[model samples]
Target: MRTLAGYTNIMSAKPGDTVEFKVSSHGPSATFSARLVRLITTEEHPRTAGLIERDVDAAFNGEYPARRQPIHTGSYGYVEHATAFSGLEDFTFQTWLWPTLLGSRRQTIAGTWDESRSLGFALEIDEAGRLTFLMGDGQGTVSTANLPTPLVERQWVFVAASYSAKDRTVVLHQSPRCDIGDLGSAETRKFDIAAVQGKSGQRHFFIAAHKASASDGLLLAGGHYNGKIDSPKLHAGALSIEEMASLASGAAVERLNECVSAAWDFSIDQGSDVFKDVSGNGLDGRLVNMPARAMKGYNWTGQFHDWRTAPHEYGAIHFHDDDLYDAGWSTDFAFTIPSGLESGVYAARLDAQDASPAYVIFFVRPPKGQATSDVVYLASTATYMAYANQTLIARDPLDEMSMGSLLVFGEDDVFLDENPEYGKSLYDLHTDGSGVCYSSRLRPILNMSPNAKYWSFGDGYLTGWLDALGIKADVITDEDLHNEGESILAPYRVVLTGCHPEYVSLAMWDALKTHLGRGGRLMYLGGNGFYWRTAFHPTLPGLIEVRRAEDGSRAWSAEAGEYFMSTTGEYGGMWRRQDRTPNQLVGIGFCAQGFMTGSYYQWSSGSSDPRVDFVFKGVNKGSKFGDYGLSGNGAAGQELDRYDPGLGSPRHAVVIATSIGHTDNMVLAKEEFGAMHWMIGGTENKNVRSDIVFFETSGGGAVFSVGSISWPMSLPIDNYQNDVSHVTLNVLERFRDPKPFSLPQ
Candidate 1:
């Protein structure tokens, strides 16, 4: 490869073109990974000019002054410099550097030390023009020791720690080499110096008077540095060749900088855009070669826009393109932002050129509590999707199978399968029948307005959810889902899952998980929503493990006969099931033997909790959240709703309101008895909301199960209702507006 900045030339090459790079070491010690190369440009950041700071920039040594110096602004700074650790190996020091707006002494972020567990250095300007690190007086040992060193001034550093458990040692090496042995003899002390932190409960982890905490990892301050760290680093243990090489070559340092490369083949759109590394650091890059990121190894959507908006007041529609998801953007191929930019919220345009409401942020402000965003984070991983598939596909005919409105389940089309009874509901968007019988039946209803416009692009994704929620998150395709959470999901209050949102990926889970852990609320309206785990290879951004089932169960396997459970992490392990339990992390429980064609009972207070007792809400005209248990809807509703209804052949499910006689299957193992199934993670299940009178548990999640297959349909749409109280309104009231936000005399 060329220098870090040269990857663009490689990316500009057409298919079958060559991409090359070099990662050689010239220092005494060296460490590097093939993954460290990145090509930076202004393409990802349509609003910014150049890089502010790069990763792996901070460096320290006894070279300048032992004391810390503030490196601030314009993309390069040094920070948190101190006498970190020193021992028989070498004394070590570390700091971070960043670029700023104009001229400023504050870094976008700074490092924090466990002063209690670290050796503090003295920062003093000697008579010469050099910065130095000095301890107490001590006529001490001979020779020298090793220390920390930056590749150069203003470079960012991931982390640095040093220790000198041994007393007699001294030596020094400079940048590119990062070593230090001795300065001169030591003298006596005015006071005793502190030691560096060690692992576990060893004497090494002891705290010093320097003021420190063991876990002070992130410090979002501001500033940049004009100097470099001198003679740093001392390890608690002996240095092996690999370890020495690691420090020398700055292996971790490269990661600290965010490596990118034009080295991989690019066929499809990997949702390329600008992103932030850990410390307000940004990576600005994209997959210029269009065909490389394809799903089926073909670049068909090389032109369409996924969530792009109109001009003018349509700011929500800017900067996004219709990302070419191979057939569908599986979680396997991810769109990545390069490394070495400044910290801040950078926009990521995966589907369009204009900055549509869809984007990603790296340097976002800390959310006060649960960060709420109107954007939806759909799952991409085959594994998670498979999990959801198993849960949604196995339902009783007459059983109520509703998608969690607030759960953010799979897409609107998943529930439209061509199962035995209603398999015709499923549509093939790529083909001529995506709207299938459902769309054909509703076409007249939709066209009733005379000017009802047909959806020019894909399915009814936009109007289906956004119009219902009344919120403004654009329905993103598989293209822009990866980097969206950093900027997109941080603003909305709720994310809704569809009838059978079974296809979920890993990063999508992480983003959503982090979003919820931060206190966001979720409404799992459908069973087996986001359930699988999948990843994108560092090089391959398009080719995913496309799946099909022999028995039509919708369950995916590696090759032929092999199931997802049988696949390993790298070897294609699809979905990892938590287990089966009655009490879910959310208030939803699942079983398979009920919905096929049976009587779903009148939703009564199955337990003692008054909040969950459907009757407590008072039986109105039998809405979705009603106690009277309405069975169906209009002919249009029935024709539209009577499709596969998804949830086919679920091996394991948390059956909420199903017949007791059906045998439930989760992990594909044959079972002779009725097993209580469950899932893990999140504390939303059985949550006690402020509006709800008491703590309640449905199955798992901040959830409420209608215990029927068609509750979503029965739930009133807009102001139209099947009864007096709107179905979702009744449910929403119990959770939030119990007393009603509007009260009049």
Candidate 2:
């Protein structure tokens, strides 16, 4: 346990809406103090500067005690009924499965057993990858039988277990799917035991897991199944081998002669949590933890791409042992944002006597239908959620050189590496070693704290620069823009975005584009903005889905034919690949990235153009624009963007300044090349540089892009007197004017 950590329910709340904080500590009992403080970016480097917090006399401020809480990972479905499987003496259980993890672990595909009491039956994959069937008698005894052949990983196979009470015998069978022949041999095993009566208790039917006992009479689900499971069926009587073969070979349930007690058809209810039983028994089950639905099932022949258009081709539900849609933890504390509270970044600071301090960050929006200032700052909550609780320290080379020499590793980084159960970012892999495609904000996001430096350079630096300049600005989150769309931006004259606003949902993207089209001014303060095409569930809040496909900087690529999101049924990948490139909206697109260090930007020839004289009114033409800052000690570094007309940069867009002197480590983005080679490095490629761009939309709308994630970090240097700050302030002040921008004729 790394100390105290927590996360909030929502990123931004309007006045009168309640916000909840869920905090978890390490010790048995911990004393902690909580207070509301507004966060401003001072410096993100842990060793050099700390987050500047302003005490806000809000409702929460006191010392309290809290108990340690546990987090459970994995997803499964279960059917709970008083008489689900009431009086069945001889029965058979069968399912089509594609196992991802088959090495040495007991995984239950479908079971009606309670391990603590040793009763009921379970058809499971044993530790040695062989099919095992266990039938427990009313008394504390169990009859077990195992198939002779072991199963292979990631291969479709049919498995079944049947018991005949009259004969006192159990048969287990396993065979590979006909489509992918030669995967495994068809085998069966029989076992004889003393005659025992089938007993019924409080045990419920579970798919992908079984009930296991824990300390203090606590019952938890264990033996979680990994990979895909489709059309699990339970018959009232032992079915013959010929009948089982017909069912496995795509026989319709209505045509089958066997009496199915409960048959779950994952193909139905593609949009809901309910899995219907087509056998007409009405023994429907509810999915737990929200497993991936509308996936490609075993019989899928790749005839159609969209699941909605071809439902049968996508019947399987991919269930992972570590798939988490929510933490479901009880709120430790709750407070309503006061009606008069200022709109800014605020957090509930938690300090403990025996543990490290933790902060649950939240943003308070201005009063509904009102704007405190003409300038509104858009917090990249989507990006924050995408990188929530990122375990980069454990996955990446985080030494001083890899993370830049100035990068500082703090205790929070070590804590996340040690305690991975808190959850992981979409960039991480699950316990089964499969790529994590989904991430939710319902759990405690340890990396989104003020004391954390993971993504602080983006949001923290922007807020701190605003505070130091005494700029009065209202704050809104990415979720706010996603939910409300353009109406949210209609109240303000100038809208500003934070650093690294990369992960963008379709709704958010449409809203921003609509705002720009309607003559709304936008100042994109970071690079790599609007990169990935993301999707948010219509009903599931705090959950965003991403499918890494077609190319961009990514940890893993989505499997073939699986690039579409299961939530919205939309194709997932980079926006550029979808024909909505970032350059179209922000005047620049992601170009390159170098983690080692930063460089300075020089004024381009277009900076002296009389048409854009107002943008650089106070800055010197010959002087280097950005040469000093907290992050990397310079303005342009980390991820960078460049203007390219072929990729959708407007014909009238101008490159006002460009970063120079980037090291060879800064390589061109993968999307820019046809092949990977040494020519992609900044030392050889001219396109591997951040281009500060400016463009005007129809009806007086204008966009100013910094094209670098480190640009805002250079604002606080020299008491905010640097040319970077001067140029940014000039744009903001001019953008706030009610007069419509007039393009030179």
Candidate 3:
């Protein structure tokens, strides 16, 4: 509630790189303070239950005065043309609406009015789910009319409201396009007021929101609509029920009438922000806040599966009350990373007088040509960006089942709900109630900060484990690997990935594959790695797009004829659907997930192979490899991946260990089933186990997959001397050697 907030431009920066910070304050002038800190561990797990922070000397630790900044939220289109409704005795307004949040207090579908000034006209949904029309007479009196029946959310409906000033009467109609009879209704009423005329002159006309007067003399949004609206038409005269039906039935476009004042067609400029007025009234409007375009519209019949194939079917734009495409704030300060600083995780902690503190995290990498270490940790930045400031607590009801804790709410989770202006993740839904297909990292991602538990484990565990072992390793991000490709990993002997690297872009996938192909070593220390096939916009720096097309553990499925990304026009879905399953690259593919408890890994048949002797240097062959750990209280739980030859696992791949004793809470992923039955849980099915796999490429390269998200949490146990730690260190030490892997003849 304090009012100061900010975000950094980039997630990570190399030494000698300049980073910018953008801050905003809602109150009067306030001073801000910032410092550098390295987050060690804040895991609430019983095994690791303490907050730790390491300070780093920074030049900018003093306070500086700053002013208030604007925050833009919601998406809609607006027209600046001024017109007086007072002159017309009879006028009609109609539009196709697809409401996402019908239960919200109030929402505007389309209106040429200002609510604060109490003038003009508007057709909106009231708090009680009724369609209400309001007209102001400029003299101070406002006439109101309402429809009897409430509309359903996420359904396409044609809504029309008409006002006859001569008769002082108003009529409202609601007609569902589909055969859902209960969703359609109509009502008519007469007001006692005289002929009401709108306040003449330049008044605002908007689709998703009405204008409200603010203290700064700026027009702020009021009753912002969350949903899709199409083909808003304004007529100079009231039309009959038959005429309204014809307009809603697609006949209005073909047979133009003299009563039509303006009809805006949203299908013309599918990729651009400009909306054209097909009625020839020159009332073209521009889209604000970047509402999702090229979506399946009202006339869509599901004949095609891709929007590019049939552009007409994808004319709708999804608007969300929490949709924030950009912050557009000015930079408050900037800092250049010193050339001598080590490559690791760093944060800029901001403090203000009597206000809550803030932290902007970024990773520091080695110089361009510098290879200071034999090992490299690949930050799962793409996955981090995908789940940035997610609002799953508001939507998903199975929080305890998903988060593995009955009291799983964190401070960061509460912050996201209080300030929705930070925007939503791809796991969220838009204002129109459709799944969010795109996510951008250009804003502050509260959960991505140090010590913040995302999916039951934080990235700090991996970094802290490496620091405890006194290992010198470089750090690189998913974006760096994406842009630079294989060349970025060519210098490092071994690469380590963080927990839950589930989201992978096309370029990043090829880079890792190429690195493995040419004698490079990879350690996939997480489950559900390289699962979703994602795309990054070429021009848009920090935005990523995903389409949850065919099977997987998905929150929401993409609608038919919309499985392709609008940003890059490429097919989106699981990599397995494209015949490039993760088992082919890292020796394991996502199989099952459970959050109740974690189990331990047992030795597999391949563990007896003499060629893999170096993997168990300090571990007992008879004992369970990972019987104790931090995550879920064991090394294998949450989500587990398995090696299956039928799915694309290489013939030479060896499964050194497999987890056992998973509870009934763990179930097989949807993609693993062709038909649904009861034999999908870990207790019923043998496939719901993580396979610690090891395989060598033809060019002396190798791959090792831990196959569980909790595996790394087991590394910091016994002072880093446990069996899990031993096996991982053995692989890292041997993989870093200059000698090549000795393949059997």
lDDT of 1: 0.24
Instruction: Summarize candidate 1's per-residue lDDT along 1-745 as a digit string, tens digits.
Output: 1110001111111123322321112122222222211112111112222222122221110111111111111111122212222211333433221111212221112122223432223221122212223332122311111232212222222233222435422222122222264232211111113332232222121100112233334221112222222112222232223333355445553432332211112111222311111222121222211111112111122232221211111111001011111211112112233232221222221111121111111121222222333334232222221221122322322113322122222222132231111111111111211111011110001111111111111012212223344533322323234434434455544444433343444555555556545444344443333333334333334222222322222322222221221111222232324231212222332322112221222222323343344424444422222222222221011101110112221222222222111112112111111354442111121210001111222222233333223333333333233331243445444433223111111
Weakest ten-residue segment in model 1 by summed lDDT: 437-446
Q: Give a tens-digit lDDT track for model 2, residues 357-402.
A: 6778888998767899989999888888888877765665643445
Give the TM-score ranking, best first: 2, 3, 1
TM-score of 1: 0.31
| lDDT agreement with native, every candidate | 0.24, 0.80, 0.78
The alpha-carbon lDDT assigned to residue 377 of candidate 3 equals 93
Q: What is the overall TM-score of model 3 with all chains considered together? A: 0.86
Score residue 434 of candidate 3 by CA lDDT: 79
Clashes of 2: 2
lDDT-better candidate, 1 vs 2 = 2
Residue by residue across 1-745, what tens digits does model 3's lDDT show? Answer: 3456677787778887888877766545467777777665535454553445678877765676767666678777777764533344578888888888886688888877777667778899998877888777666888777777788887888888777667676767788776545445443443444437564653567888877654555457777888888778888887555666666566863333686777887777665567888887787887766677667888888887677887777777777776665676678777789888888877777777666666677778898867789889998888988888777876688756766667566666766676777888888876555788778777777777645655522666777778877888899998888888999898898999987899998899999999888889998988999999888767667778898997788878987777877766778899999888999999999999988788999999999998678898878888576878877778998889999999999888889999998887888988999987999988999999999999888678889899999888887787677888889888888888877875566
Show the lowest summed lDDT stretch of 10 residues, model 2.
42-51
**Alpha carbon RMSD to native, model 2:** 2.5
| Model 3, global lDDT | 0.78
Segments in model 1 whose C-alpha atoms lie over 4 Å from true places? 1-488, 531-552, 555-590, 593-601, 606-608, 611-701, 705-709, 716-719, 723-725, 733-745
| Residue 115 of model 3, lDDT score | 72
